[model samples]
Target chain A: MTNQQCGTSRIAGCQFTLHPMSDNFVDIILSALDEVDSTKVWKDTDDVTTCVRGKMVHVFDVTKAIFLHAAKTGEHVAMSGTFSIGCPGDNEADVYMAESDEPMNLEKSQTIDQQAGCKFSLYPLGREDYMDKIYEQIDLSKARGVEVSASHYMTRLDGDVKDIFNAIEESFVAVQEKVSHTTMTFTISANSPSNK
Target chain B: MTNQQCGTSRIAGCQFTLHPMSDNFVDIILSALDEVDSTKVWKDTDDVTTCVRGKMVHVFDVTKAIFLHAAKTGEHVAMSGTFSIGCPGDNEADVYMAESDEPMNLEKSQTIDQQAGCKFSLYPLGREDYMDKIYEQIDLSKARGVEVSASHYMTRLDGDVKDIFNAIEESFVAVQEKVSHTTMTFTISANSPSNK
Candidate 1:
């Protein structure tokens, strides 16, 4: 079922998993989780994924903080996340829907110096000119100083962690403006031994 | 660039990450890696994802084997994978492209008893009736005995691991016949505490 009209309940959420390549991965993961200020969003962690649901800004803010904190540990860390908006029947109660737009951990995460490589695919569901929109975002990411390349099933991005997240967040927001239901799936890797 | 013509090269690959929700995750991951016979594919392991490239059958076979083995250990395991075919400029030298179609570890993997919960999204790049194709696959999955439901940004499938993999593989193959370039991203969870 396609939802053509954007409903008043603009629900947004992200389901993500973080993997750290180290013997002390558990410590790294738990410590990173502790660093994030997730009080602003409805957060739940299951055996498979950690999901945060609420306002768009808060959702992105929490996911970004978790990844940044893990990456700052200097251990190879990788995160896969799916961000979605405008699902057909996703009218869940959101107590934090009216939360302030300010990101809780932005200042702390910004100070972390980590380089990240990312790949993402954006789905602008039911749009005819989907490729045009996809290419436009690729161009926009490049203009924002994130190295963009064409990869199998995804667009590759390489840059500082902050810049990469900014480019991703901006492209996702841009597509939401034109398409009623849009989703982006992305993988970000930092502190990898394979880095050139 | 969307490749309209399905080239003879027929490149296929899957990049995936496996997460075991246990303190001994590294052991589980390493032991599972040992179970998969990956000689028929071009396999590479980087910091974030392990990639298997070549013929579509072998690619899926290896990825499935790894996940099944880890799940059979009675540990909560979750895997995220992206499968893609017909990418532009993907003419890498596939040494085992001419390998036999039989999956290397099919018999062994079938013996494992594991239940899996999966969510997947498919993108027929540049296709006009993409939603129709996606809906068709959803109905097809339900018909094939996989419990299909709608979730945020993905279609959910809950069933035995074998049936779930079969539905996914069949859907991917079906899309290839119509769309020149097709990609599917899926997350599968086994032995998850959140399962009903």
Candidate 2:
């Protein structure tokens, strides 16, 4: 079900769960999301988790805003998220991976250089050409100026959280188009602006 | 600095940060952690994140307690964690991975299902004998009743989270003894007792 919305989308996305510790945690999370500019992001929440699909900019913006809002209380909270750039059935195909791109937000992209890092693996699960597809996404990430450190199984990406997530989306989405059973798992961390 | 405290450790550990979406997030998270049976889990918090190190059971117990406690608030909170089984100079050695073991917690171990799952990869960087070490660990994990699903870069383990972590620790520690640098990354999820 590829909607036209995929055309404007460049980055893949993240599915996250926010486990609030307060008695009124739900109210806090929903309100924080409401305060962000979620124009290009698609959001859906169920009992287990919330999925945010969109460009890298909107996802990180919302995530950062949410963290900032939540941590301001100085209460204990936790978030679990899976960020991916590609998988089969992505609607926003290749918007960010294109050779030439319009600056989605020049100011945000320029000054947002706090490092966010992640290690992820794409499991194509017995696909013969999985390596080829995996490399293609890696190439796309490199093209977008992301620094990738590859290992035997997972790749580590270090850079701006926005750029890193963008690279993740682009790579994940690129491979998703070719593989049906691929599952990507990521553990990501970024330096909190408030903590800094 | 390897300390004497590492001898009592049965499993490797992780340090994590929770990003909440509310101002009172810290209160919420700390309260949740406090509610758990956090006997030996060493906890240290700075402005950026909280670090927890201890045996596998306590660490996972605290983590689950925190997630459940926080999620109950039904507000969005996010957590980022680094789970490691072995690194250079780990003192715990092969306590958990020992072929025949005293049940660390027989009651908890007995009630625990055999379906815990984790996907992990050991990144040896440029180690020449990386493949051999990988297989050795794979063989060791199989011996411990871990169902291993292998791929080009990573391996998937289906069994007890404790067993899985044990396998992870055993494998990681094995290679660490031989090589100076190796990092293992894992995505772990278990059937939540509280959730059920």
Candidate 3:
């Protein structure tokens, strides 16, 4: 809650909106949000969205809880969020990246592990060879010891927080030069309960 | 830029952060932001992120321009954003959803048809039968006239904006009743220039 409580601790922040397909969105959102652990995180809501801030574990925990809770209405709920950590001067988000010296235990990483992953897509404006560029970046990521899964529409990456981010950058820069129109969207977590 | 300009317009809002893979993040962010059209969209950046508000087309245009401009540095740049169009009482984002009566041209929708798509993964917490739950959701989506691609780690859905979202909700709710925890992350857009 306070900078002192989060002092040097790795914190994370996410802004999300829940879209209920069958109406009753307000009910679904309120009921789900009620389950969140306020002790571990901070939540702010407007008519359109909700923003949650806190430690990485708590952030992920509350997000998943609210989402699943909302889904219970069986109304086709779609929760979209943008999450981040490691932003400089972002006092609340600093905890997650503050202690970057620890190496991830790759051997023990699994769906059940308290690990995280990301799925993203790069849209290159007016370029016919976007795949080529994406591949180049993927190759660069492989060189950096990151694991990536590439499909026709997007790229999925999972591994150490540092390595995965490194791969994303390498891949992003690979195609950034030829075009002046590109858009990339991604979702990340500090601690993923499982690899879905 | 003003409330009047956004009146009755189907606009959208996205708050995003660009993580450049290398050390020159400041330069990349600044240059890309400069390319954005202030005439059409309103862009505000704090110490942590940038929030862009405007018409859907303009928002997409400015986002692409910034990403591409930043990518020119040939550094890995990952952009994370939360975008929405139809939330009650969110006047600014209402434009994109206000005129929802117009049907989408499904026949002309293609990879290059100024179309958009999204890929997302659902991580179910503390559950051994996660796949079963995911399959249940997928089945619910299939009944709704949507196309889905399911892999070991994630689910890929693509189609009309309405249908895609429909499928997302159906799929999301399918597993909501279980005693497990779940998290879903996704990337979506209305118009995409290229597939990467």
Candidate 4:
């Protein structure tokens, strides 16, 4: 099913659609996190981390450097993929694409039981060795530690469009400053059944 | 041979490189502009346009859109082709796969002279079409405008990275408000030659 997998991938301005699967994205994320670790990963569930999910259509334009950063940082649990435009554009698009730097799994699930930190595992690499350093730079002690292994899929937002929009902005920051030369842009659509 | 034509051609998110010969993109754009005859296509020749004479990249995801739109509009003029992502690592990628919209080119010419009071001699579909009353209900403009036609193979930008960044932000207003899905987010990096 080439569905979208067959579409051409550009390094510059790009667009794609998003579907908010609230419980849906949360579920996948939960499952992936659970598989990684337990209590150690999620401290008091709520304390494990703050989680806010919503449905949104993100757009991003990754410059060569940003693309290179994305390529380098392939499986970041926190990499935002919102689609944004550069200077010239008819309008901004609602799409997001990103690479994670970690496996996005619970690091210490042994004592955590079923609680897994809120981390979305995503790595849709059709090519090999495209972004490895991104994974190599994961810091376990960080506030939001993203693992680079386990289950990786394009887990999207579910409920709050506003939250998703904000997250998209934050994601853009990482790609902008953390990642270099990459220009990523985003546009979030309204809440509609079609989005999920 | 194939490089000579981007008319019917389309590319996705992959950044493309170009160089100008005796026929720089300016020449091509001016020629295309004078043909439009309806609107002021070239607002500012010196500032608005960015020439892709040498190899450049398309960081936007509009290849398929550009191809399909141009094909449907019958306005595509350059040599057409598609690109693919090559594997870089085992699970990661070195090159960022592009799913960007096609680049826009309000064609220009070196030899042609602009008609009086006519900013654009020809335009596949333009800004006005984008803002039309009935058309606002839906947008056929993407298929008709930069995503598809315009042969200059470029657009213009007055500001540097900040200007472009601001433009991306400004463009996102619609997506964030009308579409109440997930909040839209943007990540930016300066799209420059030196960095790449």
Q: Which candidate's lDDT is highest?
A: 1
| Winner of 3 and 4 under TM-score | 3
lDDT of 4 by residue, B1-196 (tens): 0011111112111211111111133343344434432211112121111111111123221221222221222221221111211112112221222322223321321122211000000111112222122123323232111121121111222222223322332232232223211111222211111111
The candidate 3 chain A region of ten consecutive residues with least summed lDDT is: A1-10
* Docking quality (DockQ) for each candidate: 0.29, 0.08, 0.02, 0.02
Q: How many angstroms is residue B111 displaced in model 2 relative to the true structure, after the best TM-score fit? A: 12
Give Cα distance to truth, residue B138, candidate 4, Å: 34
TM-score on B-chain, cand. 1: 0.91
User: Model 4: iRMSD?
Assistant: 24.1
lDDT of candidate 1 over A1-196, digit per residue (tens): 1221114467888878777656566687789889899888888775456778888888888899999998887776788888888765566655678888999989998898788888777877656676667656544534366777655556667888888888888888887777656778888888765533
- Over B18-94, each residue of candidate 3 has an lDDT whose tens digit, in order, gives 54433344565667666544455666664334566655545545555555455445544444454433212235433
Tens-digit lDDT track for model 2 on B1-196? Answer: 0111222224455555554455566676677666555555556554434555555545555554554455455444444454544332344434333323332234443443434445455544224444455556445535377777642223556664456667766666666556444445444443322231
User: For candidate 1, lDDT tens digit of each residue in B29-54?
Assistant: 88999988998998877555777888
Order of candidate numbers by lDDT, starting with the best:
1, 2, 3, 4
Q: State the lDDT at A110 in candidate 2.
A: 47
lDDT of 1: 0.75
Model 2: which docking level applies?
incorrect
Ranking by DockQ: 1, 2, 3, 4
